[model samples]
Target: MRTAEQVTFGGSGLNRAAQIRGDAAALAQAMADPAARCLPMWRGKPLLRGDGLDALGLIPMDHPVLAAGLGKAIRAPVFLGLEEDGAPRFAHDLSRWEPEELDYGALGSFVDRSEQRHPDLPEDMAFAELRRVMTALSPRDAELAATAKAIIGWHATHRFCARCGVETVIGHAGWQRDCPDCGGHHFPRTDPVVIMLITHGDAVLMGRSPGWPEGMYSLLAGFVEPGETLEAAVRREVMEEAGVPVGAVSYLASQPWPFPASLMFGCAGEALAREITIDPVEIEDAIWVSRADMMTAFAGEHPTIKPARRGAIAHFLLQNWLADTLN
Candidate 1:
């Protein structure tokens, strides 16, 4: 999809600079060089500035929050570039910052840190705040924020050695954590998830999980079980959720949905059958909708169904599918 990369974190061709991960001295030098910068992640939201919020927030390496986190840092920072403009950008952490309350329509301004301050911040801010801020960001910024949150969250949760049950220390610029006692190395974990748009002619199958907002639905998705291929996962997820067999599954796109670290594999599949036998344990309901209905949903004109989430691969794929540009 032409707009696939347009998602906030989708196609920013940021230079990840993976080769520098192993060179501690070089990494430290870069951070200290004054040219280096960081982006802020509040909860899991990337900080944005400016009118349309396209102005990505820039955080210097020496910022107080980054210093506190990176001073005892674990992973090397990853940078993303604007695919359209090729400009380098940072993802910062603003979890330590304060927030201002506003109406849903006015929420967009929260991504701009210039609207608030961090004075006497609490030590334990809820992750929900981050979600709120993230919801306010553009798709691409949300993706970047989600990436930072997932990575940082991994560091926080995996501080213990899985091999020997011992405390681990951060290493390799936060990519790996080493167990002090057992000599074990633990890396950030990204669980694989298969999200597919199952099309049978002009209609696509969508489902809603239990507790989702009324009328809200998305493509059926689930984790790739152990020993399963992506194609296999796609078929399994569709069958398990909607009770519909899928064939000719093909890869489409991907997104880093870092709500605790998940890589969503977007796919397209041919429906082998039309009947949906919903699995109450897996999904609340499953239904098929024609291309015209989907277009209406995307436009927020469908009274009973909302569009797939923005910034998510599901929404991205559906948007492209509607435009006939799944190339």
Candidate 2:
């Protein structure tokens, strides 16, 4: 797995200043510093700049959009980290501000092409869905955007303490939530998911969900249940979904998939048998695609099989497999 970190959202060496997360005075100084910049997000979308939406729209802390009552802030900004130049980075949720002429239908689709532009922001800047533009961003921007989305999404969902049903307050510079009533502490959560590339001879296992677009298929994946190892999850998922027993499982690479919050563990496994008996409840359909056909699909020439979305771990693993670089 030499190229493991080379995966889209894994390799960026962003210096997440963890030490300052719990330091109040240090956090204040960093926030007040003139070099601090904030990345504004709206409804899980990060503001992207340029005509191609290839860059993050990081604005100054004192920018007009951040002014009180002008552009609403859902909550205080969460400290992201310091840049290579020592400037502080933070994520601001402007989800409270509603954009005009918003396309409600395209907001949460599998392929949301809609982009939201705030009237107060420049024309070149608009909040674009992260999945739609993840590959276009630089490695550093991808990492930062992913981190911000995961953390902010966590805060949005976990506003109450599980221990006492009391409302929790943001703490640790957005890294933690504290229950004042019960003195309970909760941290951001990242669920582990195993997405495996199962192979039998020269073919691979592929499946499609019920709601996915026609002909769209990807590697079989499932959340790693409690007390289950990555290899065990891969074997169990493949067996349950496609009735294919897997052996000789090995790690390949990983990606930070922040659709909400997930860390995808990409693995490779050898199929014990090729006979397919798909579980209808777990998947709509399952098929064994030969390497040649897979190449055709990747080239967008296959008549009935569409490749996985680019920038996703499934695509990364399949691309490496086709390139003979899984080692």
Scored by TM-score, the top model is: 2
Candidate 2 accuracy as lDDT: 0.90
lDDT of residue 201 for candidate 2 = 95
Candidate 2 residue-wise lDDT, 70-164, digit = tens = 22323678999998999999988887777768889898688899988888789999998999999999999999999989988888788899999
Cα error, residue 81 of model 1, in Å, equals: 9.4
Question: What range of 10 consecutive residues in model 1 has the weakest lDDT sum?
Answer: 120-129
Backbone clashes in model 2, listed as residue pairs: none
Q: Please report the candidate that would top lDDT against the real structure.
A: 2
Runs of candidate 1 exceeding 4 Å displacement: 1-8, 51-54, 65-116, 120-144
TM-score of 2: 0.97
Error of 2 at 252 (Å): 0.8
lDDT over C-alpha atoms for residue 84 of model 1 = 36
- Give the number of colliding residue pairs in candidate 1: 20
